[model samples]
Target: MTGAFDGLKVVVHVFGKVHDAGDGQGMLCRLDLEGLELVATQHRVEAGASPRTVRFPLRTTEISYGGTDDGKLVLKTPEHILYAERDELEPELKRLGLVSLDHVLSRERQLLGGRRRKGLAVWVAVLAGCIALAFGALWLADWAVARAVDLTPAPWEVQLGQAVLDGQTWDEVTDPEVIEPVGKITERLMAEAGEHPYDFRFKVVRDPQVNAFALPGGGVVIYTGLLENADTPEELAGVLGHEVQHVLWRHSLRGLYDRLKWHVLVAMVLGDISGAQELLLAQAAGLMQLSYGRGMEREADRRGVELLVRAKIDPQGLHDFFGKLSEQEGTPESLTLLSTHPSSRERQEYLKELIEENSGARYQPLDVDWEGLQEKLKGGAGIER
Candidate 1:
């Protein structure tokens, strides 16, 4: 029948459970808004049982819905109870215009959206700052290392090179007969190269690597394999000059710069810990094996030619040594000398030009018995590569 419920919309849904004085089970319920009543119908809780229906009239009781302490919605009167989880009932209650769920939901959405945007902005700024910090660290490290290398005293460099040499086992030449020629050549070359930081210790090691390298200070190591390959004293002189230039320019120290990362380099330069010498010298074993980059090698070649010119030796000896080796049966890397001192036809051409421009009379034959040195090393039990 059309009663007072006719004027407003009726909301219908099922409440999970309902109880009244009659103690009947819950039914699907409808809120008859115009009639101001809650109707619960069709309770068939057990099999083969007739269903019961109930009507809850608003006017008879104080009708209210609220959340209990455990967050459940309790719509109750003194005579009856309607139960549901708060989330289930709140929407229906709002739809019935009995609550302001819309205002709360919209406000929560606005708050969450604002928080998300702020958090995203913070993370973006953090990432940008990290990137900038990384670049800045790298720049500072480079500047620090360059300054440290520059500030390194000559005596310390020599000490560092000696420490490096002492750390390793090289077949150090002791025979004055063989050492005399090497000593004379280095003396003459140093005289031409002028006064410098290094005391310039030259060693003939019984290594078959066909290599010659400069240590951090003034230690120059020449392998017997390299001596075996020398066709003339001039060739030996040419190559020796190149190695000397490496020591003179402190290219070994600079090459070590590339690896001395920002933090480590800063600690080294800033701390300048004498105790750190062991840590640094330990790396000498590794650094001794490091190959010079193109720029350093080129500087060595150009400066080597200058020393050769000043020593009154043929500059072409160095050129010829490299050119002839390039035509040999191995790649440049096969020869540790070529590997450490990178060479190309371009380098040869540069040497050729320098030699041509500074060409002069050939001087003393490095004043050594080269044939005897080669013959001595032939039967020598040289060190392994």
Candidate 2:
């Protein structure tokens, strides 16, 4: 009876000496077998439970009869029932309904291993995709910003900035005390800068934070705080020269270009610059984040020093300004410096080296009306006295 059966349900009967220890009664035993185990059992019988006597049904794959020997007879089923004189029945039960230990182990291992491999593969692919996306995003941003700057008209930038400044009259915005010195320095620098294709204009802002920035169309803003810190005209000139270089090289435009490069790529793919314009507008509004590359900052510094030398101004001014800013590193004022420029000790050193190397060469100084320009700026409201 050690065989296999494929079925949904099985009923088995066991017959043997059966006694109900509970209530001092006898009971017949019948068991329901399912799947493989039913076919494994060798013998089957039927019986019931009663108070006086219990006749049990017995079903088993193997049976052994012992003459002149008393031993307990047992029946085993798929789920319950413990005692059974069924050594031969073991193989039959496994073949019919019971799961073999080896088979169970093998099935579990296969399932777990397959799941683990699948999970690992999925995670690896996702991680790789993220890395690729990050690189692609950076590349696209660079390209788009470049294209945008090329497309923007230089005159347009100047006009826009002029219009903004024009809306507020000089009397309403200029600070007399600071404006005078700043204006004097700027006039000399611009005259020294001399007829570059770009239209350069300088303005003094009343802010106390030490900072200076260049606009896309050669517009330079010098904060009063910077002028306050500058002990010499050379320092002011160096700073102004640096900002001038930023304008001449179109660094602000380039920065805008670099930042919006990716958006331009997307726009080109979509067949228009309109999308890029929208992105640029967002950036201008400070709604989008962008940063200039280190290379751009370095180039501005190098060129600024060159301009100072050409103007017969001491390049040491640039180095000194950078040195002072570097000293203030980690302070609130330093943070303001970092907003538009890279402040580093190495850069200051480089400027110093540049000045020393170019020391022997010199240029004629431009005749500038320092006092008159100062008076003009001083008359303005925002220009501090």
Q: Count the backbone clashes (under 3 Å) in each candidate.
A: 4, 53
Per residue, candidate 2 scores C-alpha lDDT tens digits across 1-385 of 2355444555444332333343234333333455433322323344653323222223332222221221333433333332333333334444444545325434544655776689899999999999999998877777666666677677765654454445443322354555555666677677667666667777776666777777666766676566566656687788888878777777766666455565677786676766665565555533112345678778878887777776677788778877887887778766676666777777777887888889797755434444454444445444333
lDDT of 1 by residue, 243-320 (tens): 899888888877676566454565665676443344455566677778887888888888999998888877788898
CA lDDT of every candidate: 0.70, 0.59
In terms of TM-score, the best-performing candidate is 1
- Output the TM-score of candidate 1: 0.61
Model 1 worst lDDT run, 10 consecutive residues:
61-70
What lDDT does model 1 reach? Answer: 0.70
- Per-candidate alpha-carbon RMSD to the true structure: 10.5, 12.9
